[model samples]
Target: MTLNVLFAARPERWESYEPILKSEFARQGLDVALSTDHPPETVDYIIYAPNGPVQDFTAYTRCKAVMNLWAGVEQIVGNETLTQPLTRMVEEGLTGGMAEWVTGHTLRYHLEMDLDLARKPGDWSQHNPPLARDRPVTILGLGQLGQAAGQMLAGIGFPVTGWSRTQKDIEGITCLSGDEGLIEALKTAQVLVLLLPDTPATTNIINPESLALLPKGAVILNPGRGPLIDDDALLAALDLGQVAHATLDVFRTEPLPEDHPYWHHPKVTVTPHIAAETRPATAARVVAENIRRGEAGEPFLYLVDRDQGY
Candidate 1:
């Protein structure tokens, strides 16, 4: 079938995906027209990026869906002009990168590797760390990224507990959900990883009250949405030893203003939003597959439900 796909992402990204996309389409035996600018009202699917120039989707009357290249869709979801189905990027590249980064840091802290490596030769102090089974990890969100990281930790014998708004069943992980289950999950968590989406309900999810529920020397790792954690409360928790340290990969602001306390904090590790990245080569194929399904009268994969707000 012929499809009028609009590639609304930036000019820079075009070169990366153009060849790969064309090859994928040809393999699927589909006739496709790619356009940098939104076409006349007949646009069937829009390949989107929130930072791109396409804001008004109302004109694209025939558009079946807005397939986002980036996983975080909070930027474009709130637009009133958008009436089309929105699907966030779900690809192996992103999932693998997130799992690797989270697991790397979790193991680093758990093993006390940094302290042992930096110590002077004469002072071989045997400051042993607790066993993996004794250390509990509380993962917020329990979504794709969270679940993947939890499984990696669980494989190494760490007692992993996951907290989400809804209950989930996964092998080797203690999954907790809803308001009541939060406290139970937090109490046993020595390491907390934030992976929740940034909706109104999730804002400041790691406030002082929630932070207090965790073990006193808990380490906080945020590779998820920036606003899910309250900046001030995290620092306060660190001040009182409620939270021993925080490894932050996201922030409320991009470029993370020069004056931010997290930048200077001794107990904080600030990564420039590099926890996970969408690889255009792989992500474009996922986008194309969904579009193919829509064209072939098959159910779309990863279709966003606007009412649930993801």
Candidate 2:
């Protein structure tokens, strides 16, 4: 049977994803009628992006699942019309990219790289950095991306601790959860990385009260959601020498307003939401695999939990 797959992202994305999706479907040996203009009622599946034109899923009566093209589903997870099974992208490329970014930043903090880079041209200021084992690194999320980064950091000798809303048991990393675990995790976080998703519970999670738990002069790296850290709280922390520096990528507002304090903060590094992006080549294969699973009566991978909102 041929499946009618609707590509529901922006018009420009159709051009980029069409051939890739087609190639993947052919490789999977599936007959798929993939297009941007398929009749809504006939669409057996939808390749979706939150920025897409398809807001009302009510029209797609036959759509068995909504396969998100991006890793984040926060933008579309609450759509009342979207009652179908929703799956977020979980591809190797994204995981690998996140691991690299986290590891690079973690090492930068561990080595105090900025101190050496900012030294005076003629002044020979001698500074010594500690080994990875001496530095306690904490990750806020223990999901796929977080676990991958944690494993990489642990492999390199960093004492890695992972925290989540619920308990996890990943080998080679200390995993913590719940309120008490949060405090314990923060107390030893000489370097902290935020990889949690954007949700009500996660917004402003790094507030003043939570920030106070970290060891003095703790370094923060946020490749996760922008609201994960409270801007004013982080600024205050930096000013008081509570936090040494912060590297923020995602933000509440895109293009990070010109007047945003994070842009001007001396100790803060603002990266323009470029920590990681979905690559069409690898992402296409993941989408194809999920579609194949749906057809074969197997469980979908990375299905989002509506109640948890991740």
Candidate 3:
């Protein structure tokens, strides 16, 4: 039997992924009908991106699942018409890229090497930096990216503490969870890193209370979702000298407006969402594998749970 699949993202991606996607499906020896659009009556599976133009899924009676191309599903989970199973992308390339970015930035802050590069000519100043052991790093949201980052930081002799919504015991990590645990974990950390997904429980999670738990002049790094931190609270913390500086990657708004305060803040570093991205080659392989499974009567991988909202 042939499974009819419709891809909802743009043709630009199809043009880029057609070769490898088709080749991989061929290797699996599955009979499938693959196209950007045929007819909703024939669509058995949908390769989706939240930003895609498939708002109405009431016509998709045959679709078994909605496979997302990206890791985040916040944009589409609440659609009442989307009754089929939804799955988020969880591929090798994304995880690896996230790990590398987190490690690179952590090391940069740990060594305080940026100060020397920012110095003017002949304005050399002798400064002795503290050892890695002296830097207590706290990682918020001990999920995939956070766990990987925490482990890497710990390997370099920095004391790593990780916090999540639920308790976990990771080797080489001082793991904590729950509301009370979050405060205690923050108190011990000199550098705080945010890597939580955007959800109701996570939105504006980094408020004044949590910021106050950290030691004075603490540094913050956020490469995760922008909504994870309370913007007003973070700004206030920076003003009071509780937070020395903040390095933010993702933001609530993309292509952040020129008039935004974050753009002109002297203590904040805004990177235009370049932390990590899913490579086309690897991501295409992951999509193909799921399509192969759907044909072979096997369960899909990285299926998203709408209840969890991730």
Candidate 4:
């Protein structure tokens, strides 16, 4: 039987993903009618993006699942019209990309590479940096991306601590959860990394109270959701020397306005959200595997919990 799968993202995305998805479906021995224009009632699955054309899922009566093209589900998880099971992207490429980016920035701060890079013609200021073992790094969110980054950081000899809404038992990393755990995690975070999902509970999670918990002059790296940090509070912390520097890859606004203070802040490095991306090649394989699983009556991978809003 041919499964009708709807490619519900932008036209450009369809242009890139069409051939890859077709190859993956064929490799899995699945006959899939994959197209951008599948009738809603006939769509067996949807490869979706939050900004995709299909906003209302009410017409998709036969869709077994909606496979998100991105890791984040905050935008579509709350759609009341959609009752189908939703799965977020958790492909190897995306996870590895995040781990690499997080590890690179963590090392930069740990070694104070920026200071060396800014040396003058004759400025030979002797500065010794501590080893990774001496630096305690804390990562918010222990999901796949978080765990991958935490493990990489731990492998490099940094003491890694990971926090989440629930307890996790990953080897080589100290895992913490809940209110008390968050306090402890913050207290020891010499280099803090935010990889948490965008949820109501996580909005402004790095506000004044939380910022104060970190050791003074601590550094921050945010590659997660934009709204995770309170912009005003972070600016205050940076000015007060509570946070020495912040390398932000995500923000509340994309193409962050030219007038934004972060653009000119001495303590802030603004990166244009290039931390991690869902590579089409690996991501297509993941989407195919999930569709295959759905057809075979197997549980889908990376299923989002609606109540938790991840």
Candidate 5:
């Protein structure tokens, strides 16, 4: 029997993803009829995006699973109508992109490159940077992206510590978990990276109390969710010189609001949320593989825990 797969995302995304998904389905040896328009009741699976047209999932009674196009699922997890098993996108492209971005920014901070780049003419003051081995980098979150970033940093000799809500034991990383572990992780972070998901428990996790844990003049890099850090607390920290600089990619409001304080703050570097994006080729394989898993009765990969809200 041919499985009906609905591509429920933006029109532009349909054009980009249709052929890749079709090719991937063929490569996986699955008889999938992929389309942008399929009767909700007939859809065996939904390739979903939060901004997509399919909001109410009550009609999609046959949908065995929802394969998300993006890595984050905060927007879709709360939909009361969505009862199907949902899987977040986890592919080589997304992971690689995130790792590379994190590495680039981490290196920038470690090397103190910005000072040289922005130096005034004839102001040649010599400033030498310590090697990566001397830098203690802490990452909040030990998921695929975080782990990959940690591994990359570790490879370059940075002493990397990773903290998650749950314990993880990845090689080359000092993995910490629980409340005590968070405090310890913050204490050691000369440079800190945020990669945790957006959940109630995680929102504003990097507030005043957490900021006070870091050593004076610590650098912060946030490519995770915007709400993870309390903006007010971070601003206060910056004013107090507790945190020397912050490079923020994701934000509570996208385009970061023209009048946002982060934009005017001299200590903050805001990059339009370009840290990572789902690559069509690799993401298609992930979607197709999950569909194949659903068909074969195997457990899905990257399935979201509804209660945890990731």
Candidate 6:
């Protein structure tokens, strides 16, 4: 029996994903009828994006699973109508991209690169940066992306500490969990990276109280969800030198409003959300593999725990 797969993302995405998905399906040895307009009831699986048109999942009675193209599922996880098993993307491309971006920003803080970059032509002041071994870096959220970034940092000689909702046991990382562990993680974090998901427990996890725990003048890098940090608290922390600088890549409002205070804050560096993106070439294989798993009756990989909301 041929499986009907629906490509239910934006129109432009269809142009990029169609040929790759078709080729991937063939490579996976699956007979699939792939289309943007398959009848919802006929769809055996859906390659989905939250911004896509297929919001109403009530009609997709036969959808075995919803394969999300993006890593973060906060946008679609709450939809009451979506009852199918859902899997979040966790491929190499997305993980590698995130690791690279996180490492780059981390190194920038470790070396105080910005001061030199902004130096006037004649202003020659010497500053010596400590070796990576002396820098203590803390990463919040020990999921795939967090683990990858932490491992990369640890490999480069930084003492890496990771905090998650539950205790983790990754080699080479000082793993901590729960409220007391969070305090310990923040205390020595000269460079704190936030990679946690947007959940009720994590929202504003970086408020004034948490910010106060950091070593004074610590640098913060947020490539995770915007809601993870409290904007007012962060701004206050910046003003008081509780935090030396912050490099934010994600925000509650994308294309962060022109009038937002972060735009004019001297200590803030805001990059349009480009930290990690789902690469079509690698992401297609993940989607294909999951569909293959569904057909084979094997448990799907990266299945989202609806209750935990990741």
lDDT of 4: 0.95
> How many times do residue backbones clash in model 6?
0
TM-score, each model? 0.96, 0.97, 0.94, 0.98, 0.98, 0.99
Instruction: State the weakest 10-residue window (summed lDDT) of model 3.
Output: 16-25
TM-score of 1: 0.96
Ranking by TM-score: 6, 5, 4, 2, 1, 3
Pairs clashing within candidate 6: none
Give candidate 3's error at residue 7 in angstroms.
2.0
Better of 1 and 6 by TM-score: 6
TM-score of 2: 0.97
lDDT (10s digit) by residue, model 2, range 1-310: 9999999998988887999999999999989999899999999999999999999999999999999988888999999999999999989889899999999998888888888888888978887888889999999999999999999999999999999999999998999999999999999999999999999999999999999999999999999898898889999999999999999989899999999998899999999888888888999999999999999999999999999997
Clashing pairs in 3: none
lDDT of each: 0.88, 0.93, 0.85, 0.95, 0.95, 0.96
Winning model by lDDT: 6
The true-versus-predicted C-alpha distance at residue 221 of model 4, in Å, is 0.6
- Mind giving the per-residue lDDT tens digits that candidate 1 earns over 1-310? 5688889888898999888888888777779987786464978888899988799887899999899888788888788999988998889899889988989999889998879778997986887888899889989978788889999999998999999898999888999998889999989989999998888889998998999998999999999989988899999999899998899999999989999999999999999999999997788789879878988889888877676566
For all the candidates, what are their Cα RMSDs to the real structure? 1.4, 1.1, 1.7, 1.0, 0.9, 0.8
lDDT of 6 by residue, 49-166 (tens): 9999989899999999999999999999999999999999999999999999999999998998888998998998999999999999999999999999999999999999999999
The superposed Cα distance between candidate 1 and the true structure at residue 67, in angstroms, equals 0.2
lDDT of 3 by residue, 218-296 (tens): 9899998999889999999998999988989988988888988888998888888888776777887788788778767
Task: Output the worst ten-in-a-row residue range by lDDT, candidate 4.
Answer: 8-17
Best by TM-score: 6
